[model samples]
Target: MRVYTLFTPSHKGLYEDYFLKTLPDEFELHATELFEQECPTGSFYHEGWDKICYRKVELFVAACEESMGEHFFYCDVDVQFFGNVVDLLVREIGDFDIACQDDVTAYCSGVFVCKASHTTLAMFKAMKRNYNREDQTTLNEHLHMCQHKKLSPAFFTYGRVAARPWSGERFRVPENVLLHHANFVIGVENKKQIMDYTREKNFS
Candidate 1:
C-alpha cells in the first residue's frame, strides 16, 4: 500500500516537521506540498479551511492516479503513526471500496484506506465536483452511496480522544490503535509540545 498526505504553508513550522520525521519507512509515502502556484485554476485559493480541503482532494486524486499500489491510504499531516498502519489497514480493508473511522456525522477523512479502482476514481471525481462544507463532508456523502467499511474509533483516534483531558472527558487510547490524529483541537505550538512528548514517551 502507498500512503499519501498533504502539507500547506501554515503547517510548515507545525505538522510538517514531525510528520516527515515519524513516518515509517515500511510504506511508500507521498507528501505533497501545496504552494499557491500549485492550486488548480477555477478553484478558490484563499488561505482558509476550504482551500486546504480543495487541495487535499486534488492531491489525493493525483496520488491515486500516480501510484502503482493496488490500495492507497490518505492521511492528514497532523496524524502520527505508531505501528505498521499499512499492514493493519490492508488486513482490515477486506472487500470494501473504502474504509475510515466514523466521526458521528461523517467518516473522518483524515485517515482512510481506499482500493485503487475505477469506482474509487469516480467517487473522488464526484467529491471534487461537490465541494460543499469540507472534504470530509463531501467524502461522507459519496461513501454513503458506495461500499465502505466504517472502522472503529480505536483504530484511528482523533482530537476528541487525544485531547479528552481538556474537555473534562475521560477516554482510553486503545492498545491496538495504529494512528492518532490531532485535529483542530489546539494551536500549532501546543501540538508541537504534545508531539514532542509523544515521541519521547512512545517512539523513542
Candidate 2:
C-alpha cells in the first residue's frame, strides 16, 4: 500500500527522511505541499499557520477520494509510528471507508484512515465546513457522528488508544498505542540537539 504525509516548507527533510527509514520498503511515501501558497496567513491556532493547516487537510481528504487504492492513511509529521503499523493494520482492520483514533476526551487527531469513495468526499466537505484551523474539532465531530451511527465505526477501528474501553489500557498513546506524539517544546538550542540526535540515531 502507498503511504502519504503532508508537510510544509518548515518540515525540512529530517522528518520525511526518518519516515522513509522507518517504514518497510513496500510502503511508498508521497510528499506534497500541505496547502496552497496563496491562502492568507491569519491567526492559525496561534501559530500563524492555520490557513495552510485547513487547506492541507482538505487537500488530503480530497486527494484520497480519487485515489484508486485500497487504503489511505493520514498522519501528522510531528507524530511517528513506533511499531509495525502496516502489520497491525493489515492484521486487525479491513475494508473501511474511514477509520480514526477516538478522542474520548475530545482531544487527539494524530492519525486517521479512509477508503476511496464519494461518501468520504462528502464527509470531508462537511468536516471542512466551519473549520477553525483546529483539526481536532472537525475530527471530533466526525468521531461523534460515527458513534451515533450516522457513520460506521466498523469501517473504522480507532487506534489502540481508543480501544481502552475494551482493553482497559491507559489513554496516553506513548504507553498504550503503537504510536507516540512527541510534543517536544524545548528551547531552540535543545530542539536542535534533539533533531541532531534523531539524525544520528535514525529513531525517526
Candidate 3:
C-alpha cells in the first residue's frame, strides 16, 4: 500500500520530522509540496486557507486515480503516529471503497484510505467537478452512494482544546489510539505542539 500527503513549505517539516521519520518502516510514502503563491502556510481558515483545502482534494484525487487497483492512505502532515495502522485499516477495507475518520457529523478529510476502484475514482471526480466551498462538505453529499467505512477506536481525532483537560474541555481520546491528529487548531506551530503533547501524554 502507498501513503500520500500534501503540504506547503511551512508544513513540510511535519512531513520530514514526524510523518516520514517517526512512522514505522512498513509502507511507501509520498508527499506533494504545494508552491502556489496563492496558497497560505498556516492551518488557520480564511480565503487563502479555503483554496489550500480544496486543492488538497484535487491532489488526493490525482494520487488515487493514478494508483487505481491499489489502496492509498491520504494523511495530513499535521499528525504524529504511535503505531503502524496500515494492516488494521487495510483489513477494514474488505469491500468498501474508502475508510476514514468520522467526527460524527462529517468525514474528516485529514486522514483517509482510498481503495482507488472505478467507483472511488468516479466519486473523487465528482467532488472535483462539483467542487463548492471545500472538500469535506461536498464529500458528505456524495457519500450516500459511496461504499465507505467510518474508522474509530483504533484512531483518535480531536482539536487542541479537547486534548488538554485543563482547558475545561473533556479530554477526548481513546485508550488505544494509533495516532493523534492536530486538526481543529490554527497555526502549524500550534498543531505541532498539540501533536507532540498528545504523543507524550499517551504514547510516551
The TM-scores of all predictions, comma-separated, are 0.80, 0.62, 0.88
Candidate 1 residue-wise lDDT, 133-173, digit = tens = 67887887787555898666645443545434223233444
Measured by TM-score, the strongest candidate is 3
lDDT of 2 by residue, 45-153 (tens): 4454566667656765666665645666666554444455665554443655555554444434545555656666666667787575666667666644332111212
What local lDDT does model 2 show for residue 50?
Answer: 64
Give lDDT for model 3: 0.73
Per-residue CA lDDT of candidate 3, range 1-204, in tens? Answer: 788888878788788888777676777877788877344545555547778778877976788777899988888887778888888888877778888776556677787887888787788878888886777777777776578888765667663234321222335455688876776667767667767767766854
Give the Å shift of residue 190 in candidate 1: 3.3
Identify the runs in model 2 with alpha carbons over 4 angstroms from their true place. Answer: 34-44, 102-104, 144-178, 183-204
Q: Report the candidate with higher TM-score, 2 versus 3.
A: 3
lDDT, residue 112, candidate 1: 84
What TM-score does prediction 2 earn? 0.62
